[model samples]
Structure formats: C-alpha cells, structure tokens
Target: MYRVWNFVTNYSLLLICGALIALVWANIDAHSYHQVVEYPLAFNNWVGVDAGYWLKKYGADYGVTEVSTLKVLSFHYLVNDVLMAFFFAIAAKEVWEAVVLRDGALRGRKAATPLFATVGGMVGPISVYLGLAYFLGSETYDAVVRGWAIPTATDIAFSYLVGRLVFGAGHPAVRFLLLLAIADDAAGLIILAIFYPSGELAPEWLLLSVGAAVAIYVLFNRLPQRLDRGKQDRPNSTWVRKKLSFWPYLIAGALSWYGFQESGIHPALGLLPIVLTIPHADRSFGIFAEAEQHLTDLLNHIEHILKHPVEIVLFFFGLLNAGVEFSSIGSPTWLVLAGLLIGKPFGVLLFGWFAAHPMRLGLPQDMRTVDLFVVGCVSAIGFTVSLFIASVAFDSSTMLGDIPVQDAAKMGALFSFAAAILSVIAGKVTRVQKQNG
Candidate 1:
C-alpha cells in the first residue's frame, strides 16, 4: 500500500496539481493563459510548427506582421512533442516486458480473458462516441467522427489507484484492471500511429528509425553478449556496462526521434523502437512492483533515472494541454462522458462473461463476474491519456456549430475524474468483499 501511494505521489500528484492550476488560470484570464502557452522558445526550420502557419493564425491577435521564418517551437510543443517521448518510452518498456518476458502478465492463457475484455473496452467507446454523433445528425458526425478514439484511453496510474481503493490490494480484479489498462495503452499507441499522423507521411524516413534500432542492438548489445558466451567473468560485457554505459542507446534514441519527426508519426512515440533494443532482466515482477526497484538491468536503471524527469514533464503536459474553458462544455463533452461512463461497463461485462463461460477462459480466483463491471468503472477514469488523444484528434481550428471541438472534447476528458466516484459507488452496490494481501 505504501509503494502504491508512493508511485502515485511521484507520478500523478504533480500532474493533478498542474492541471488544477491551469483550470483556474484559464478560467480567470484566458488571453494571458493562451499567451503563455504559445510563447515561442525558438524559431528554426528543423522542428516545430511552421512559422508561416503560426503567424497567419495568431499574428493579428499578437499584433505581429512577421511571416518569413522557419518554425516556432512553442512551450506547448516542447512538453507535448519533445519531452513526452520519454513518458511513452516508459509505457512501451512496461508493455514490451509484459509481452516478451516469460511469466509475464500478458502472456499465455492466463491473459486470454483480460485481453478479450480489452478489445471490448475499446470497441464499446468507439461505438458509443460514433453512434451518438450519428444520431445528432450527419453534420455533427462529420465534425466529431475523428475523435472516436479519445474515450478508449485508460489512464494506467489513475485507474490502478482507483482499483486498489475499490477492491482491496489482494483482489484479482486489481491485476485484471492493470492488464486491461496496459493492453489498452498498446492499442492506443497503434491508433495514434495509424490514424492521427502529425504531418504528411514519408515512408523513406522510417528506415532511419529502424536502422538505428537494429544497429545499436547488433553492434553494442548483441556483440558484447556473444563475445562473452563461455566466459564466466564476462569481461567484455562488464567493460561495455562500466566504460560506455547508456551513451550508445541515448545517441541511437536521438536519431530515431528525428526519424519519427521527419516521418510524420507523432515524435512522442519515437523512443519505442529504442526501448526494445535496451538490455533487460530475464524475468518480470509486473509494473509498480516494489521488487522491481532492486533490479540492476540497464532497462530498469534507465526507468529509475527517468522517474523524476517524467514527473516534471507530466506537470507541464497538464499545464499546456488541459486549459479548456468552462464555456467549452457542450455536446462533445457529454458525448465523451457517455462513451466512458455508459459504454465501458457494459462492454466489459458482456465480453468478459463470454470469455469466462463459453470460451473456457476463467477469471482469477475469488473474482466474481460482477467484479468485471466494477473494473470497467475504475478503468473509465481516463484523465491523462484521454486528454492527450483529444489534443491530437482535433485541431483548435475545428468547430462544431459555435463550439471549439478540441476544447469541448478536452473538457470531457477532464471530467472523467467523475468515474472514480462512480467506481466506489459501484463497488458498494455490488457488495465487493475486501481482501488484503
């Protein structure tokens, strides 16, 4: 319990603090807030939004006439695009370990039921978000259809926290919720890469990212292990670990990030390929496992080094991306809420039942079928990743009637905290038995 609270304080408490400050600041003085969020840190052709586009969109408001420049790297871009890559890399490491390692949570038949439920979790939100838009009218559907993936996100940290509160720390449902959230994150990454490209697609540039991963894995990682195969002391591997350290992978990660930026995929996912190339321990202890802190592998060491820096990045992430005004609460807000609150529970229950009974995949011991619905309720607290999806799904210029669709959608994401209350109520209504490990 102490470890769980420590993880939340280190990662999520700062983010919530930043978000609350932004909400207050945005409502009080929107103009000043916008000015700070868009403040340009640099103007160069190599990265960031095009300078011509920025000037054309905001110059009249800022009383500027400059248009012939390279690009504008705003404060928002620095946190969301460049720094957030480390956040996603951490997520990818967890997912990679879950899939690749023996005895991993996501491997073998033990994961089948939860994996099926994960699919339903995503499908339910898309159906509700799109189906409601269709009923609103063809024009409404056309405007909001792009954001179908927004509600599918499940913020792993917040959901896990809420799950522990609702079901005791020893309950199997908590582990189920973790598995579903991790799989949902994996699916969300694929959705972003395929559907919401940052710019025009260029296939040739991806070769650079792939080449960097392959080169580093073969030259530094694979060669060192191969050279020390029969040697008990393993001097070559020791020298690489001691003398060179993480420099090789860091250099390769930079090249991969540039490749993703030029290739039009979101640069925040650029570190994923490099994450796979890092050396890891042979076994797994699950995410947020207290036992994990003692591991001496390079991957875990890198994750430990990043813990504080990523917390700071998440703070700026909330400050920049969560500044929607109260007036922005409109149809899209309700639509997103409905998708999360209404669709997710039913979707999880129905599919989870099918897998447990018909498909012969069983639930964890002492976990009743009703617990699936409560798990869904906890999973619907999609604060962090849902807010991120809303940002990339619709540009600020997009309008649905008189509302800014991006801001409205963001308000919906922010409101997802209500699901935490809903989850507690559901647990009480369902008469969940607490089990302390």
Candidate 2:
C-alpha cells in the first residue's frame, strides 16, 4: 500500500493537480486559457504544427493575417508532441522490460487469463462506444467514431492505487489488475501507432527510425558485449557505460523522433525504438518496485534519470490537454463514460471467466472469478491515456452539432475518475473480502 501510494504521489499527483487547475481555468476563462495553451513558443518549419494549419485555426485570435515564414511551435505542441515523448518512452521501457525480461510479469501461463481479459477490456469498450454512437445517428457516429480507443485505456498508476484501496494489498486481484493495465498500455501504444497518424503517412521515413534503432543497438550495445566476451573485467562494456553512457541513445532517440514526425506518426512514440535498444538487466523487479532503483543497467539508469522530467512533462500534458469546458459535456462524453464504466467490467468478467473455465487456464490462488470484474472496474480509471487518445482521436475543429468532439471526448476522460468510486461500491456489492498484507 505504501509503495502504491508512493508511486501515485511520485507520478500522478502532479498530473491530477495540473488537470484540476486546467479544468478550473477553462471553466472560468476559456479564451485566456486557450490563448496560453496555443501561445507560440517558436516558429520553425522543422517542428510543430504546420504554418497554414495554425493560421487557419488560430490566426484570428492572435490577429495574424499572413502566413509566417516559419511554422508555429505552440506551447501545446512543445508539451504534447515533444516533451511528452519522455513520458511515453518511460511507458515503453516498462512494457519492453515486462515482455523481454526472463522473469517478466507478462510471460508464460500465468499471464494467459489476464491477456484474454485485456482483449475483452478493449473489445468491449470499442463495441460500446461505437455501437452507442451509431444509435445516436450518423452525424454523431461519424464525429466520434475515431475515438473508440479512448475508453480502452487503463491508467496504471491510478488503477493500482484504487486496487489497493478496494481489495487490499495482499489480494491476487491487485497483481492481476497491474498485469492487465500494463498489457492495456502496450496495446494502446500499438493502436496509437497504427490507427492514429499525426499526419499523412510516409512509410519510407520510418526507415530512419528503424535504422537508428538497429545502428544504436549494434554499435553501442552488441559490440561492447561481444568485445568483452571471455574477459573477466569486461573492459569494453564498462568503458562504454562509464564514458559514453546514455548520450548515444539520446541522439538516436532524437533522430527517431524526427523520423516519426516526418513519417506522420506521433512523435511521442519516437523513443519506443530506443528503449528496446538499451541494455537492461535480465531479471525484473516489477513496475514501481523499490528494488529497481538499485539496478545499474543502462535501461534502469535512463528511467531513473527520466523520472523527474517525465513527471513535469505529464503535468504539462495534463494542463494543456485537459482544459475542456463544462459545456463540452455531450454525447461523446456520455459514450466515453459508458464505454468505460459499463463495458469494462462485463468484458473483463466474461472473458476472464472463459479463460479460467473453458480455456483451462486458471486464476491465481485465492483470486475468485468475481474479482476479475473488480479488476476491470479498477482498470476503468482511464484518466491519463484516455485523455491523450481523445486529443489525438479528434480535431478541435471537429463538431457534432454545437459540441466540439475533442472537448467532449476529453470531458469523458476527465470524468473517468468516477470509476474509482464505482469500483469501491462494486467491491462491496460483490461482497469482496479485503486481504491486507
């Protein structure tokens, strides 16, 4: 419980604070809030939103009549597209370790049930969100259909925190929830990369990203170990670690980021390739485990160094992305909320039961079948990633009647906090027995 709370305070509290501040500011003075958010930090053709798009969207507010010689690097773009890459890089690191490490949580038979449940968690939300939109009419459905992935997100930090509260620290469901959340994040990244493009696709430019990954891995990682083979001192690997450190990877990541931006992929995912190339310990201590801080592997070292910066990035991300006005709450908002609150529990429960029963996979000892629903309820707190997906899923210019689709969708993401309270109630209604460690 202490560890869970500690993790939340370390990573999520500032995000929540920024979100709350944005909500209040947006409601009170929307124009000013938006002005600050869209304020141009730089004007360069190499980065940020295109000049024509910026002019068309916001030039009137800024009183700019002509296209600038350079593009606009708004404060919003700096935070969401560039700086937030660090946050997602950290996420990718955890996912990479979970899948690649020998003792990874996502490995082997133990993960089967949770993985199945994760699929359901995603499918259920997409079905509910899109299905309900279809009923709302063609205009509404077309406006919000792209945001189907929003409710599939499960914020790992908040979910872990709530899981501890609902089922206690010792319950197997807590661990199961963590696994599901991690898997969901992994899937979300893939969905974002595939389904959501930051711009027009250019497959050739992805070569730069792939090339960077391969080059860095071979030159810095593989070469060092190969040279150190059969040597007790491991001189080459040690020299690379002591002297070069993470600089090479940073350079490679920057190149990859540029590649992604140019390739019309979200730049926030740029660091993902670099994460895989970094050398890591063979074993694992799990996400947010205290023991992980002691690991000297470059991967862990990078994550440790990134911790503070990523927190700040997340704070800014929340501040910039979560400033939807109260009036923005409409059908999309309800659809997002319904997908999360209703779809998640049933999806996890039904699929989890199937896996544990007919599929012949079994739950962890002492973890009841009903606990899967509780885990789903806990996983439905899709505050952070949900907000992110919503931001990318729709443009601010998009409207369904009077309501801005992006803002309405974001409102739904913000409202997902309600899942926390609902989870507690579900635990009680289902007669959950808390198992304190």
Candidate 3:
C-alpha cells in the first residue's frame, strides 16, 4: 500500500494526471478551457487592466495608426514560455552533467553504442516522417515537412517510468535508455534553438546571450580559486562561498534568457550555453560519485533546487499545452503517430545493430538485442518536448496557420500513451526471458 501510494504521488504520475485532466476538460467543455487559457493578465499595459483597454494602449506604443491593441499573452503563454524556461534550464544542466561529470554516462567507449543509437533514433524518425509525408503527396508533405523533429524527442520521465515498470529496478538497458534520452534532449534543445524562432534574427542579442554565458563560466572558475587564495580558515567559509557563488549564475541565467527572447530564439536555449560553461569534476570515481561535490557546485545546486519546482512547471505545462480537441484530429495526426510508434523503434534498432557490428562496439554485456529493441519502443513515448516542438512547428500564421496543424500535432503527442502499453508488454516478455535464461 505504501509503495502504491508512493508510486501514485510520483512526478511521472503527476504529469500524467495533469495531461489527462487537460484532455478531459478540453473535450468536455472546450469553450471553458479556451476561456481559461485565453484569460488576460495585464502586464505594463498602463490601462485599466481590461483586455480591450490594454490592447489599445499597447498598440499606441508601436506607432500604429490603427486602433489595434498590443499582443497580450494568455495564461497558457505564461506557463509555456515563462515557466517552461526554468524546466529547460534544469534539463540542460542534467545533460551537461551527464557528459562532463565523472563516471558520467557519456564518459567512455561504453557510451559509444548508446550515443550512436541516439543519433540513429533521431535520424530514423525524421527520415520516416519526411518520407511518409513526401509519399502522401504535396499537400501533406508541405504541411508536415517542418515537423520532422517532433517525434525525435523522448520524454525522459515517461520513458524512465515505463522502463522501471517493464525492466524492474536496476536494468542496464534502462540506464542505457536514460543516457540516450539525455543525448536526445540535448539534440532537441539545439533543434528548438536553431529551427524555431518568432521573428527576424537579432545577432546582437545572441552575442549578448553568449557573452553572459562566458561571463558566468569565467566567474565560476575564478571565484573558488580567488577564495582559496585568500585562505580564510573559518568554519562557515564553505557555506558562505557556496551561497555567494550562486548569485552570479542566477543573474547570468536571467540575462541570457532575456537575450534569447530578444534574439528571436527559444529562450530555453539560453541555459544550454551556461550549462556547458559550468565546470565539472573528472568522472574518475563514477557517475554517482559527485554527490558530495555537488554541494559546492552552483549548477548542481540550481538543479537540485529546481527538482521540485520543475514538477509544478510540468503540471502547468500540461494544463496549458495538452488540451487537445480530439474532434479536430486529422491526417497530420497519423504522421506524428507513425513517426513515433514505428519510426522511433525502427531507427533505434537499426542504429543499435550497426553500432554492434560494423562499429565494433558491442552492446552492454547485461543487455540483449531484445532489450535494446524494447528500450527503443520505450523511447517512442515522446511527450513533453515533442508537444513543445509540435507547438512551435505549427505556430506560423503565414505558412501553416495555427489551429488545425497544432491540433493534429497535439493528437500525435497525446498518442504517446500507446507507447506506455507497448513498454508493459515488452517488459513482461523481457522479464520472462530473463527468468528462462
């Protein structure tokens, strides 16, 4: 009973619940859902705070002669654009840590297979998506060509959860899947930063963002050295140094986030540069060995503090983004479904096989080919990041318009639930195989 209670209260379960609530609310009373999401919260409008009044006042600032209002972001925008930035920041930190930290997943030759598999996973789904779209004729091809990156994402939490259920605790394949997912996340962040933008590129702002990241890196590296040089042998010196060190990173992160926003790139990428800039200890001791060292590392501290907050962010993220109007589902939805369901596993397996043979790097001793295949199936659960890309891919008013394309993308993202079922069945088969062996 206690275990069941713990499981239900887990972050994965919370995310699932949030998504389910959004789905039910949107389907049952879409008008109410829309109204709630669209409800205006005025910021710097200089008006009576009414949506209409704020719009007119906002428009005047831009020298528009027309009686148009400024673009006021809805509650949904606040959650996705604002809150999700922190989520991405933490995610970036995790990916950076995995690569640079001692005993990290990406540290040695052992990681080669999974790294290759990650690339394969990404390339495979996108190839399938584009091929399917092209074969569907011009209209479908044109509509979904930009959405190739959507199904390439792997929801770390959902995949991890399904992995635990299927493979039980402490499976090598599960760990491998996690490493692949982290790499996939890094790739996804790059794709979002490079591919999705709201307006013309502002290179100056991008420079500022990079500059801020460099500044943070410099400060992080130099501060401890300077402090040690002073050599104050006080009992609380460690605590003081740790506390003081965090402010620079906070300021730097804020600056970069604002810069990315101004630079017409997704602000979530702001953290990626900063994350890479943070120094990590040699992973000689192993991946989990840095627990003690994390106390002094600002990047690790920031990630730890964000662990709980990210859950809240994910909930609101789902509430805002997962409200798919199922009735509006169409052909584009199949593109997403096929890309994730079929393309994901095929790509993973194809790449894994190549890595094992021609590449001369074999799979982990404890893991079988079937285990890798099941991991690929688990990777098919492309939830959070996939939905985010879907939103970005279909957001253009000039090219693809919004509602229909966005809705179809959402339907495909929501269909990741099917992957959960596949994980369970595959997990059972693997468990039985393990017992028989």
Candidate 4:
C-alpha cells in the first residue's frame, strides 16, 4: 500500500506537467501563445520571458528577414544541434560512470539489466512506430533521422527519482535499473551518431572525424590500464596522471566536432572525447577493496558533478523549446499520440515481462508488477531525446513539399509529450489506487 502511494506521487507530477504544456501549445497558435494578455502587449513583454524573443532573434541573426520558413529551421538546428550536444555529453558521463567508473547502483543491476533494458528498449518504439508506418501507407513526417532518438533514450533522472521512492534503501535492483537506463542512453547515442542527419560533406572531413574517433577510442581502452601516477591500483606511469586534466579532451572533442560538422554528421559525436578522458585513477579507492569498502560514494561524487547537469539541461531544453501550443488539439492524429504514449507502455510491458518470464525473473525483488508498469510510464517520457531524434529523422530539409520538417518535429515532440502524459497517468492512478487500498 505504501509502495503504491510512493509511485503515484513520483509518477504523477511529470504527467501533469506534460499535460499542461501540451494543452497550452496545442490550443494556442505560436504568436498568440507568446502574447501575455492584460499586460497591454508591451514591447518588453513581446520580446522577453519566452521563446518569442529567440524565435525572432534567430530570424535576424541567421539573416532570414522572414519568420515564415527558414527562421524556424534555424531555431530548430540551433537548439537540436548545439544545445543538445551538452545534453549528450552529460548522458555520456552517466554511461561512463555506469560501465567504466563502476557506480554502485549500476554494479548491483549488472547481471541482467543491460540485456533486458536493451531488448525492452528496442521493441517498444519500433513496434509502435512501424505499426503506424504500415497503416497510413506512409507515416511520412519530416526529421526522420530523429526517430531513432526516441526508442534509445530513457529518462534517468525521472527514473532514478522514482526508483528511490519505490525501492527505498534496501533494494539492490534500483542500481540495475540505473544501469539499464545507462545502457538505453548508450544505444540512443549510437543511433544518433549513425543515423542522424548527414549530407554530402567533404569526404576528407568525414574521414578525419572517423579517424579521430577511432584514435580516441584506442587511447581510452589502453590508457586506463596503464596510468600509474598518484595511487591508482592497477599501476601506471606518473606522467600520464598529470595529463588527465580537461583540455586535451576539450581540444579533441572540439576538433572532432568540427570534423563531424564538416563531414555532414550530426556534429554532436564530438562529445565523446570528454567522456574518454575522465581521470579514472583513484588512490582513495583502495578502501573499497578492504574490509570496509566504499567506492560508491566517490563514484556518486564524480557522476553527480559531471553527469547530472546534462540531464537537467536536456529536460530544460525540451521544456523551453520542444513544447507546442496545444490550442487545436484533438483526433485524427490521436493514433500517433496513442502509439507513442499508449502503445509504447503496452508493447514494452508485454515484451519486458516476457523477457523476464522464461528466466522467472520476477519483478525487481522489492518491486510490484505495478511498479514495473510505472517504469513503463517513465520509459514513455521521451522528451529530450525524442525532440532530438525528431529533428534528426525528419531532416530540417525534408519538408512535405511545403510543410516544414522543423515544424513537423515540433509537432511530433508534442505528441510524444502527450503520450508520456497518458502513460504516466495510467501508472499514477493505478499506483494511487493501490496506495489507498
């Protein structure tokens, strides 16, 4: 009963927030939504406190006098390409802590978390998206490269927040859930790197980016084991320790971003070097190996400082930019809405449990099936990455002859947001009922 209340409180708020955003966007047109009524429509009001300013600024900054077509495209590219790289870097840091830095919760979930997460992650979106694609003779939208981003992402902040509430202190499986989310994040990054917008860029630049990436990877794999500076356990040379500061990585990452940008790749793949270069050497980590062990706290420290900001930005970016005015909201497009929020939870729940069943992998020891349902709800919160993927998949260029793909991405994200809300409500209500019972 207590568990139910916990889930409801944690899961329900996100849904409510999403609903408010969607309602405001779907119902109101762009400029009208920006206009603050009763404020007497002052110039400051028009040009301040909202996307209205930037939307106009981008129009001028990009040299597009008209806000009709190219302005939105410029805004879309700026937000998705530039702002999102920071978001992705933060995600990569989480992954770094999980897979390489050895975060504790991640350690606990190590056994089957990655596998189930990978599978559950794959099935839900493909099923929902492809099913729709088959139906309309074409699920033709723009920013098609963006589609891959949705399925691969898991909102770790929201998930972990729910996890703490649901699992309290004892359940080791929370860690596993954390790891699974990490894995989901990695998959999303791969999908973005491979599938996001690319065009005919100078092959030489593309090759340079690829080469740099490979070189960085090589250095990462070998460098970790060899660093012997301060007091790292395995052993390493003293000199390598000094070099681990942030610059070389910044340089490599910056260069890589340039190459990728020139090469026609999404350009954000440049964030990888920063991840590769985090100093893994821990003289203080030896305490964990002894009778009284504790690497977890230290891992948490590194993860928090390096990783948390990115997720925060990702969420903030979505709220600020991805939101649509829901003034005209209603049917016809509800299937896409249903597919994202509704079908997503259903398909993932079915498949996730199915993956668990044969192995008799009951819910995470302390978790109820309903808790799993809530997890499914959280999975449906695809905001940050979904917006990114939508932008990528439906290239800003792939306009439907006249309908701009950027607007289509904005619309798709709106639907995805709604879908997340519905799924959250389902979970929240069920949880609340169980709590009351």
Question: Against the true structure, whose TM-score is highest?
Answer: 2
255-328: candidate 3 lDDT, tens digit per residue = 88778767878765666677666645454232223343355455566666776787887787778778888876
| lDDT for each candidate structure | 0.90, 0.92, 0.72, 0.49
- List model 4 lDDT by residue over 269-360, tens digit each: 65665465545533322111231122333223344444444444444355445444443232213433444565556655665566566666
In candidate 4, stretches whose alpha carbon ends up further than 4 angstroms from where it belongs are 1-79, 101-110, 139-152, 162-176, 201-207, 210-244, 281-316, 323-336, 360-363, 368-371, 396-437
Residue 338 displacement in candidate 1 (angstroms): 0.8
TM-score per candidate, in order? 0.98, 0.99, 0.85, 0.64
lDDT tens digits, residue span 1-437, model 1 = 88888888988898988888899999999999988888878878887877887888766666768855677887888898899999999999999999999778899998999999998888888889999999999988998899999989998998998999999999999999999999999998899889988889996899999999999999888999999999999898888887888889999999998899889999889988999999898988999798889998889989999999999999999999899889988989999998898778878888888999899899999999999999989989888889999999998999998899999999999999999999999999999997878
Judged by whole-model lDDT over C-alpha atoms, candidate 1 comes out at 0.90
Model 2 TM-score (2 dp): 0.99
Q: What is the per-residue lDDT of model 2 for residues 1-437, given as tens digits with 9 covering 90 to 100?
A: 66677778878999998999999999999999999999877778789998899988998998887875567899999998999899899888888888989889899999999999999899888889999999989999999999999999999999998998999888999889989999999999999999999999997899999999999999999999999999999999999998999999999999999999999999899889999999999898899687887999999999889988888888899899999899989999999999999899989999999999999899999999999998999999999999999999999999999999999999999999999999999999999999998
- Residue 347, candidate 2: how far off, in angstroms? 0.6
Worst 10 residues of 3 by lDDT: 284-293
